[model samples]
Target: MKQRLIILSDLCGSEKSDWLIYYTHILNQKYDLVYYDSCQLGNVDTSSNDQQIIHQQFVEGGIRKAISQLIELEQNPIKILAFSIGGLIAWRYGLLTGNIKSLICISSTRLRKEVYKPKGEIELYFGEKDAYRPPMEWFINQNVKFEVIPNKHHEIYTEREFAEEFSLKLCNIQSH
Candidate 1:
């Protein structure tokens, strides 16, 4: 059986970004990939049609739902790739659920206290120019591997080449 990979996108979800397409291609080469768009999974109220409101809903409700889904899927340990606010969700969720085999986060802030330490390895990628970089203490205490992508923003991994390289790294983690 192939390994599983769950990818969580940022505020606007997978449709708004290219991360899904690129990463899915790479993961599909070696694993069965599952894509979860945080906005859609949480079923946040979008009646107002405001981007900020939608994003807020993702932070408040979507993250929780995403974590619950991951926990429910724990029968099959999977590698998770999260971007931006999605990364924040993954961190908190991983700490709480402790089911993922590995995690790769991009340009995310540490917003909540960690309740569960990850049993799997964690890789965090951040841009030097991103505004939301967390304090050194946060990363240092978590023991997460950090990578600085040059000239990247909050959405650095959205690029096809970047996603491909990232997916390869994720696959390697599962193999080892």
Candidate 2:
């Protein structure tokens, strides 16, 4: 049987996210993929496109709600490919439930607020230009592996080239 890989979307969820094809097309061939929309999981209102409004909703209560909902839905070990706010949800899930096999977080700037690290094979990627990305000291203190992609910004994961390259790298890692 193929390994299971869970994909958690960014705050935008599936709305206007054609870029997801860049990763899904490649990852589907090697794993049994399960996709989750962050907004739906968190019960965030996405009627408006204002990022600030959406982000505020998540900050108020959505993130916690999503984590709880995900824990209730997934009980077994999981490997996660999460973007932005989705990464934060996965991190909290791993911390609370502790069954993550591996976690790859892309552009999860909000992680700067976290102090404790979860137990898992964790990899974090951030754009060098993303001001909200956690400082190098945070990574060192957490003992987590991280990479800063040069000349990129917060939404770097949306790029097709980056998605393809990242999917290739993910395929090489053995999942349990």
Candidate 3:
């Protein structure tokens, strides 16, 4: 049987997530995949394309609401591949539920605000050029494993090459 893997969308959610096919094409063969749109989960308005406006909503209360909704929806141990704001949500879910089998967060820059580390197997990937990404000291302080892809920017996960490489890595991890 295939393992269940939840994929959480970035802040822009499904509407702007055409890039998702890059990961799904490879991951689908190895895992039973589920997808969630962060905008819907967080009750954020997706009508506006302005990032600042969308982000403000999450900061106001969307994130908390989303976490509560997620807790209600999921009851079993989970593995997650989350991007951007979705990564933040997944991290909080791990902390709240303590039921994460594994978590992979990419370009989750908002994580810099978190003070506590969730209990689970976690890996964080960030682009070296992401100015908002947490500093190396943050990872060391949290005792979390992480990687920085040299010469890449915050949206590297949306790139086909990066997605393919990560999908392979994810497959290896699942096999082991």
For residue 117, model 1's alpha carbon misses the true position, in angstroms, by 4.2
Our tally of clashes for model 1 stands at 0
**Better-scoring candidate (TM-score), 1 or 3:** 3
Q: Which ten residues in a row have the lowest lDDT in candidate 2?
A: 167-176
Which digits, one per residue and each the tens of the lDDT, describe model 2 over residues 1-176?
88999999999998967999999988988999999999999999999999899999999999999999999889998999999999999999999999799999999989999998788899999999999999998999989999999999999999998988888777773333
lDDT of 1 at 86: 70
Query: Model 1, 105: alpha-carbon shift in Å?
Result: 1.2
Per-candidate TM-score against the hidden true structure: 0.80, 0.96, 0.96
* Candidate 3 lDDT tens digits, 1-176: 99999999999999999999989988998999999998899999989999999999998999998888888888889999999999999999989999789999999999998999788899999999999999988999999889999999999999998998899788874422
lDDT of 1 by residue, 1-176 (tens): 88776777777775567557777766787887777776665666656667788877776777688667656655455688787777766766666766667887776654425534566878888876676776667778877788777777766777777777777776674422
Candidate 2, residue 68: the lDDT equals 92
Off by over 4 Å in 1: 46-50, 73-76, 110-117, 171-176
